[model samples]
Target: MKRSRAVSLGILGAAAFGLAACQTEEQTDAAAFSDEQSCVAAAAQSGWFTREDCAATFAEAKAVHEETAPRYESQALCEEEHGAGACGGDPAAASGGGGGSIFMPLLAGYLIGQALGGGRAMAQPVVPKAGGGFATPTGGTQLSRLNSTGKMGTTAFAKGPTTAGQPPMSRAAVASRGGFGGSAATRSVGS
Candidate 1:
């Protein structure tokens, strides 16, 4: 009985040891690339592999194409997954098949931002005037700012030197009821 108990304990210890070895997370991930998509995603996630790496390893893994080693989707998709100029196909031809150069979209986004003045370091804020006129903080280069009715009023005009003989063109100083209905002023250039 004593010998049998010892043998059973030894067997149990060996089984525990074997089970412990199976719980390791360091299992090899090298063969994790069962297909091109998974391999591309993994390699791209590492940020080390390029498009050539994808074509060479992934495409070659499955005998991708007869003409090409590993056929790629589109330049745009490839560039997105890899880097610029990473795709194997012609960029123009791939436009209908897949998106083209990624730079063009980025460039277009930059231009759109610039056109809306969103890219400016300091954008001019819309200032509220007493006569319901909206103007920039500095009143801009224009002599008069537009009012709510889309008409140029005298509420927020940039003040220049008053003419020696001519009267002021803006009625901004004139006090009116309900903040509207002020007399129109004629703006004049150099006399």
Candidate 2:
């Protein structure tokens, strides 16, 4: 019973942390993606593209550049004058921008958690298994907690006489009479 109670508390604490983490992730994503769609839409709204003009420009530029120089000579001169970027035109240094350092630790943590089974679980209760295993507490269930009462709880499964399908708790108030868990806490009509 004590272990179950501790498990309940732990589940409650985990749930609180989960809620906080979810809220933080949502806020971070919102901040990061802000105005992204608007910027894409604005860029796409520029209706200045003509396929014929694009083709003509490409052909004219290609003819002029090719006619002006020998390809191998131009390549050798480019490599001598500038660097390898003259060939590919795109490199890590050229694509550099203002961004924080990569969080390798965070990636490692995520991978470790995934390896340790941090995802959704299978169906199982957090109690002594009927066959002799143990129940893993997923979260605290309010139905498991007794309302201020001594009764076995309406949520309790049917023993010998108690019916299985009952309400959350017995209607008879046990707190007022100052008795709990099947103690003598009777009530009269007037009081």
Candidate 3:
């Protein structure tokens, strides 16, 4: 009698451990479903649910979709939950959506580059004033036109050069000319 009782207890403990392990696998599988159709299909594929159980589960998910907010772990998760372009107009619980300080670094780099003499001073596109004279520049030119003969800042190309009669190349084009370590000289070396 004592041996039988110990054997029964051991079986029960093993059963409990097996059930716990199964529940963990089920939870991981649950996390893989981003929406109702996929979830229902996965449940059906697993062969653990009856046809009636799959229908009931899908109905419950549909009802929940009408009532509660979606908790998305990331923009990607939200997009997967709904569909592509679904998260464009802000969804609940999306992470990493806030604006950052984009202008600070741009302004700092502009000022630093200007000080270092590596910066090219650009002629602002002419904007006509109300009366016909040139509009007063909001901020004056970077450095006073370097000399009277129209030598602006650098000894390099005074005014940005044009390409194939197209408009003059932009500052960015000038900055990122060739592959690594690109400069005006590097661009000329290629062509």
Predicted structure with the largest lDDT when compared to the true one: 1
Write model 2 residue lDDT over 16-68, tens digit each, in one string.
11112112211100000012232233224323322332333334323322222
**Total clashes, candidate 3?**
0
Position 191, candidate 2: lDDT: 20
Candidate 1: residue 70 Cα off by (Å) = 22
Report the lDDT of model 3 for residue 178. Answer: 38
On TM-score, the candidate that comes out on top is 3
In the predicted model 2, the residue pairs found to clash are 126-135, 127-135, 150-180, 150-181
Note the clash tally of each candidate.
Answer: 0, 4, 0
TM-score of 3: 0.21
- A best-first ranking of the candidates according to their lDDT comes to 1, 3, 2
TM-scores of the candidates are: 0.17, 0.18, 0.21
Ten contiguous residues minimizing lDDT sum, candidate 3: 103-112
Candidate 3 residue lDDT tens string, 95-174:
33543210000010010001123322112111111211211011111221111111121211122222111222233443
The superposed Cα distance between candidate 2 and the true structure at residue 105, in angstroms, equals 42
Stretches of candidate 3 off by over 4 Å are 1-45, 70-84, 87-191
Q: Rank the candidates by TM-score, best first.
A: 3, 2, 1
lDDT of each: 0.23, 0.19, 0.22
